[model samples]
Target: MIKLMKSTFYKEEETKKALANFILEAEMLSMGEECKKFEYGFAQKQGRAHALYVSSGSMANLVLIQALLNLGRLHRGDRVAVSSLTWATNIMPLIQLGLVPVVLDCEKETLNISSQTLQSVKATDIQALFITNALGFSGDMEQIRKWCSENEIIMLEDNCESLGSQVSGIKLGNFGLASTFSTFVGHHFSTVEGGMICTDDEELYDMLLMVRAHGWDRNLSAEKQRVIRDKNGIGDFFSRYTFYDLAFNARPTEIGGFLGNRQLQYWDEIVSTRENNFKRFQNCIESNDDFLSLDVRHMDVVSNFAMPAVCRTHESFEKYRKRFENAQVEIRPIIAGDMTKQPFYKKYVTNESLCENADFIHKNGFYFPNNPELTEEEIALLCDLLHK
Candidate 1:
């Protein structure tokens, strides 16, 4: 049967062998030189000045939020606008850290919050826009970026789903001040389970380093570490045990780091395969009037997380769902559905604005597996399932 994740790693057998030898011969296995190497490599590759590796994508979100708070960029009661069509962790950190969330509805075509959505939203006083690049698709991000700059909004991207995606010659994650990524098994890049936060801002990057560890200056450069110690009057001996700010132990191990290094080699191959498959799937959808054709023409590349089919009606959704089920192809709801409909969100956040488009997509949408590992035969079967 076809599955959401076909394999654990891109070059599965080779990575496993290398990891076994590294573990057996290496003296240390905790977050060490390998993790640092991966961070440097990933930052350079992703076109960012700094990249902070974390334990999970969820931790990446939490750490970023904490770092923003520690730097006084975001406050306890400030309102942050987020796309209604996003994963739970994308919004959880906002609520968990005492920031009020204003859910912004997405466009039906792009499945992401467009600049038009920003103009239409009732919440005009939002301090930040925590936008999600949903299903490897983004809105008119260039115009959105200009609007954010003009309005003085702190924009951050939850780019977990769109690792290799690009728009207007710039990567999706680089559009915002800082962006977060997931390297879980099913994502575009896999490190078993890991995450990354990329930013060009050095001060925020340093704060993120402290937040990833125990709020210490251990991960910083020698000069920066000395500055923090001298400013806090923390001597060399006492600094080792000192906790300077509120933080969590979200550091990744060498295993994840090693796996990331191995996976980074095939970013181009993985992305191209997924983008080609997505185009084929899009062609099938265009011919089938039962499903809605997604708008991704503005995007230069789509490292699609999964091939989403949003039917025009619930009956149509059931029909397509049955076809995929009959073909042994797995499918699931689109990224945890609407954020406001989640139980955790409902329990914590009340008086939220209605997200009609997101709610509609939640009921009508299901995503087919579009991983880079899909064979030509599997692609044909998926395409057939998507048609009629």
Candidate 2:
């Protein structure tokens, strides 16, 4: 049976052996050197000033929002626009933090919010945009970035699914003020369960470090810790236990850190294989009349996380879904289709307009595996099923 994820990490045997060795001699299992090294490497790879490792991608988003709020960049009741067809965690933080969320529709082809969608926001009250680079597919991000800048809107990305993807020669996570990444079992890289927040903004970076660790300066640099403590008039004894900001205990374990660094070594090969599989899947689906393919012309490199197939009709969706099931192929709905439909959103938000294209995707889109470990035979079988 073909599965959504064949292994936890690309080099599973190596990860297990390394972890086994670590279990024997490791002195500490909490956040430490391994986590620090992983953050540094991730920041360097993404061309960002800093990267903060956290417990999960959901925590990464929560940390980012809290940091921005702490820095006075966003305030209670501030309107934040979000792609309607994104993960629930991406929008939950807005409501949790007392920020207002305005749902924006994504284009049917890209499965991401377009520049046109940004322009369609008739209200001038929207202060920020949280765009999700869904399933490794992004809209014309450069265009969207320019528009956001002109409107004085802060743009952030939920790049959990598009870690290695790029557009117009820029990495997906780097196109915004800050972006979040996940390293769950099914993501581009696996740290078992870990996440990261990457940004070029030094202030935001500093805030993230504090927010991630029970809102303390413990994770901050020695020099930074000294400066902050001195400014707050707190002596060393009291400073040791001080909570400095609104935050949580979202720190990653040493194992997550060790695995993250190991995964980085194989990043290139992993992404390349996924991209190839995406192209093969695209070729098969493009020739069939019953499916609609994502528009990837604007993407310079696609680090495809999954192969999404938007059926032309609900009947077609059922037909393909049953075929994949009969063939023992695993399948999943595309992201968290139409975020407004979520119970959490329904409780907090009132009278949101229909995000038409997002709703279309919610009703019709489903995805199958595109993991790098897929064998040639598995690929041919998947493609043959798609062709039918």
Each prediction's whole-model lDDT (CA): 0.91, 0.90
lDDT of 1 by residue, 277-330 (tens): 888989999999999889988989988979898999999999988888888888
**Stretches > 4 Å off in candidate 2:** none
TM-score of 1: 0.98
lDDT of 2 by residue, 85-187 (tens): 8999999999999999999989989999989888778546788999999998999999999988988899999999997899989989999999999999999
Superposed Cα deviation of residue 345, candidate 1 (Å): 0.8
Q: How accurate is candidate 1 locally (lDDT)?
A: 0.91
How far is each candidate from the true structure, as Cα RMSD in Å?
Answer: 1.0, 1.1
